[model samples]
Target: MPIYVQMARCCWIICFLVFSSLFRAYEASPGDSDQLYRACLSQCQKTSCVGARCFSCCNSASDGSPLDASWYNIKHLYFWWNHWDCQSNCRYHCMLYRENERAELGLEPVKYHGKWLSRRQYGFQEPISVAISALNLVMHFHGWRSFSNLIYYSLPLKPDKTPFYDYAGLFNIYGLLAMNAWFWSAAFHFREMDLTEKLEFSSFVALLGYSIILAIIRSFSLRTDAARVMVAAPIVAFATTHILFLCNYKMDYEWNTKVCIGMGIAQVASWSIWCGATEHPCRWKLRMVVVGGIFGVVVKMLDFPPYQGLVNSEVVLNASNIPLTYMWWNFIKDDAEFRTVNLLKKVR
Candidate 1:
């Protein structure tokens, strides 16, 4: 891993948490506060119409919420199941109408509530990001599947039937954590709700913190369980404390950024060093990943608005990860085989 992995993960978490913590959340475009947009919203709430387009949810409430609506109306609104209600429908329609007018007037598109305007597909609020996150999840599943097959099905097992590779279990857990993190990431991008946001933030931080501990274990070759636990205890403590603070107490964006930056830099540096020292066949892939990760970090730092009001910087960041992820998993597979073969030869 290089800077991009940590930077991408942290930036995604920080961008949302920071913006939400710092300002009033407007679910629509930055023009949400504009007099015209406000007036349009008010009219939509009262009349259930945005221009000639009318929404049934709006008819259920003056404020465009179904909180006071009858059961049938509530059921009707939730039937779509994409989490769309009167307020969101009104905001989406109004924002598009406003942006279309702005385009005609030659005005640039602006962010809404700290979010760049994004095109939604199949009810995904950020379709590109959601899709890419899902792809990343698939990559993990692929890697985990292949690795497990190689260990359990292809290779000879020990007396107790455990895989020959010493680190097999560790990497298996790693793959699971990676998959879990990506799943939450896709969900968060689909809709930035309180629960999804917390899970997305917590899952990645946990994964990263665990990765750092794993890096220490693998790089140092801490084979003994006690040695590994000694290396992990502090990291686990910090991660648990931070997650609790973020979820239970308050989300301290600045503090979290500092912690992630420090830990991420160390993790990348250690892996780069180990990759260089290791004579494994897949070391080349690890080296390539290191270089690419650094370049990606640089890429993520350059901030630009969504391209064509659809693909944003975050989506691009997620896309950049797909290849890195593939190569990294490939390296893990090779490493596992290499280690297993070495163990068998020792027995011989």
Candidate 2:
């Protein structure tokens, strides 16, 4: 085989491996599974043959667990007729015995789920985060409406020969990506399934990286299609590689966080510098967007959280998008009016 063909085959195999990793589900730790509990219950039952609490005999007075016989009894009584397996009943009784001993020693009982106060206060799902993500989706809709008007009504007003006017389709795609990112964010907060979480993170990274591409193109006045494509291609490639690495390689939270923060800083800096240097009437609106974005970034930085109510970093970022979207609408409308006026002048 030709060397190039051999390389292509290697590439295909690597791609297959990367994609295969995405389908692999995250497995919980052994303790969270029922197998160990069942095995322990079996041994306990075979030895003692208790009525409903097989592990009841496993407790010792020296361990201070004997004082919690009533606690174990409560669990045994609860699971007596529930069709629970021997292991499950034994596990429940053991849990009560442990908690009772912890109470005696004045130590907090170990949490089986996690230390997240959000789960304790609001159950599994963070409703506030979901609501904020929904609001962000609505904001994206408003942005899309403005962008649609800009494309359908305003874009056509430009001289058909202009290369810049041809970017309406690309702009529409970028807008759709933004909206879809928000949609996934909402879905993740609503259910927090593994797939949804991955989608949400991947979508957000795509949007953030693409926004940097847009900023560079728009700021440098890259009008020609080729120029825009050339400017965007590398960033898009980087974004794609980042996503593949996350799915296939180690999903290191610190590494992902640093990359995201760097991209965000670049995006904000590009827009801020452009707005500051330009003399457009909409500069103040862009400044407002910068302010809102910075506030969102600050919220993200202070993300050590109980994750309850509206205190979630994702929720605040989603809410911040509202003002930024409205400001973008006003700025785009201003630009559209400028384009319409210029077109009419040429016609006359």
The C-alpha lDDT values of all candidates are: 0.75, 0.61
Which tens-of-lDDT digit does each residue in 1-348 have in candidate 1?
Answer: 764445434533543453245343224335655778788888887887889887676654455455445665657645555656667777777777788888999998865444556766777788788889999999889989998999999888999999988888899999999999999999988886668878987997898788877776776677998988876887798779879988998654444544555555556666776775567677888888778766655554454578777776667867888988889889888888888888999999
Tell how far residue 205 is off in model 2, in angstroms: 0.8
How well is each residue in 207-278 modelled by candidate 2, as lDDT tens digits?
988887777666565678897788678778878998988777755444565567667766776677667667
Worst 10 residues of 2 by lDDT: 112-121
Whole-model alpha-carbon lDDT for candidate 1: 0.75
Clashes of 2: 0
TM-score of each: 0.73, 0.63
Full-model lDDT, candidate 2? 0.61
Clashing pairs in 1: 29-112, 30-112
Deviation of model 2 at 283, angstroms: 1.3
Error of 1 at 201 (Å): 1.5
